[model samples]
Target: MRWMKQYGRGDNFCGYYRLLHETFRIESNIERFREEFENLYPCNNSGKIGDITESYFVWEEEGDDTSELIYSVYQNNRILYKTVDPLRLLPFLEWHLNNTTLAKLDNYLQVHAGVIAKNGKGIILPASTEGGKTTLIIGLMMRGFKYLSDEVALIDPRTHNIFSFPKNLCLKEGAFNLFDPLRIGIQSKEYYVRSSKGRVCFINPERITPNAIGCPCEVAFLIFPHYNPSNPLELKKISKSEAVLNMAKRLLNLPYFQGEWLDILVELAKKAECYNISVNNLPDTVELISHLVEER
Candidate 1:
């Protein structure tokens, strides 16, 4: 994809790319996205015209209705996705870019899981949207666990270790009020917005825990978390074989079954203790996990 003018560039574990565009109005939104994501893709330079850094177009002419603005994403001249709603633009870009990053990482395995580590021991919360994964991630962060990832969990298949894939936490409007520190003691309207997921806010992890970014750590436990406000917190041991099959189903960009990668994943599951936890109290859940991490 070619554009007359380039505004910004991004590069990280994913890939290096320039965001090129001509419109100032859409450029401003791109700037906001760049501000949020550039830290993860900390390239401070823009690519030259036609330079072939993975490129994308966020073009909406000035005075155009925001709802009608259509955007296209291209990598190496191949159009990946396009949509009419501007609300999906940022997240669409993020989700694809993250997957793109994982695809290029031959040595790493990516899972649809939230991970948090402490003192070189890591816990994997294997969950999907139904599991309240983000809420549990925030609750653990409040209790002082280093933030690894709220979405994708990167694993070194060879070492059975997990690393962080940090991104802004997208909090549902309802959960925003439950966590006081996340709210910063003020109204959430300033940072809130609507998306395909409904009302949400993007939170910088640094605000809650400085240097909370997680490092590679041994995969000590595989935890499946569920949140139910009316129930008591409960943790029950699960079969490693069951954990392997279940967590394997959560692989986002891993190789197919019967492959070497599949064997590696099974090995990872076998090495770690697995459990299912129902969390009614965030504090109790945190305390329980903290003890697990602290124990021999």
Candidate 2:
């Protein structure tokens, strides 16, 4: 079996998927992969090319037709990750597409963060993978804060305004209890027990409300969130220089844009207040953030 298809032609993000197999159940796998990313992959069929294209190709080796599958993935013809489990293929594709598209973007400064806004000002939470960004942002959104992004914080370098990426928040199975007190329930169909990132589920921001999504806004705060149940909630001010340096390390798409990102990064860091927050309780953290937002 052999198949190829492209998604997001005119948008900033795009993906191309190709599959080759000797005699595996290709139709079933293709159907499942497309269904998984249907909502996340927006269609833009203007016949125009994007800044980046996330290319993924999976192929089985010669003379290998056993139930024990060994598939390999390639990005732009270079092998990136290989695995024996086929269930992880779709999510593996998504991870590459999300990062590459953002990395290749020239128009926006992609900060590795979660963004929530109120009163036309945005809060930037710069964190890495599993940095408590999604949990904290979800708490803020439930408290009436608008969502800009759960993935990367897209910022206009010149205007200092933040745009929305607004991808679904991917949460692990263990984190489901965090939303129980808020009366949010996870549907069984949304659960993926064998994802590339392990057992996880995607929760949309609009689950809070249709108006939960936010638009571009001036940045008000740059925060780093650290979740620790053993520690009390605390917030400490950090220097703008320190904030800029720290954020630089977390940038996903800036390296592909060359040296132009330096000035943009410096300007954005100077515009927003910087802080480090250690969170023990979600409700208390939200209250502290609300008080700070109100004070500004």
Candidate 3:
């Protein structure tokens, strides 16, 4: 049996890659993507251009300074997740194919892919950054829902699709506090610490969904998480068009979602239920969504 592995371990894993629909082409391995530049190809910096996605960054560290490196979406000649570890890098590389990233180098992929599942009955929680998407998903996995990508809840361009890239959930800084009761392990040194949101590897055996399979995700609810607000957890319906726009906003890879692709995705939003979940509090936020999930 000829065996080949990408990023290490599991060449036959291509089946899962296909099922997860994580397939794309590498646009190029050039020095620089943007023309207004020089010494571009062998870059060691990170930042965002353009008026809208005008994000800022610095060459935090050299890839040579890290342990193992993997450039998932090496596009527009930008350096993302120049990690000192491969495991930390591989997930994104695996999820966002070279083709997908190339399509939306400047555009980001958006979706609250936290514990998103049909769960016998279609119930979705459209959560986002700082809304405890990971926290909520980890909690649900404890109850018996399948795991999707903790961060990138990949939406398939065809099935109007949402996919599952089940793996270890990302724990950002203080976010680890919530899992105290569960006592998830944190592997230090491996994570590429960030100023605002550093990474942590957390997986609760109790929360690990047996085989960790993917589910055809359906967002029955859109919970616009509001952490630490002086407000109660309220639910409201979101319009389909509005939902599609929001999903696009949440996409880490947005640029590629253009033309006919955008049309298909927009239609998807029109087909499902959307809700705004106001979560100013963690316990309150978790409880509110738990109740909503149970109700569905």
In candidate 3, which residue ranges exceed 4 Å CA deviation?
1-115, 118-128, 185-196, 204-209
Encode model 2's per-residue lDDT on 181-288: one tens digit a residue: 444334444555344357666665677656877878989899888888898899999999898898888887765558877887778878898999998888899999
- TM-score: the better of candidates 1 and 3: 1
Under the 3 Å rule for N, CA and C atoms, how many clashes does model 2 have?
A: 1
Ranking 2 against 3 by lDDT, winner: 2
Report lDDT per candidate. Answer: 0.66, 0.69, 0.48
**TM-scores for all candidates?**
0.75, 0.72, 0.56
Q: Judging by TM-score against the true structure, name the best candidate.
A: 1
**Residue-level lDDT for 108 in candidate 3:** 27
- Misplaced by over 4 Å in model 2 are 1-35, 39-63, 68-86, 181-189, 193-196, 254-260
- Name the better of 1 and 3 by lDDT: 1
Query: Pairs clashing in candidate 1?
Result: none
Question: Could you tell me the TM-score of candidate 3?
Answer: 0.56
Query: Across residues 18-131, which tens digit of lDDT does each residue of candidate 3 receive?
Result: 112222222322222121012111122332222112121212122455554333334345755454333334334433342343344223234544545636333445555667
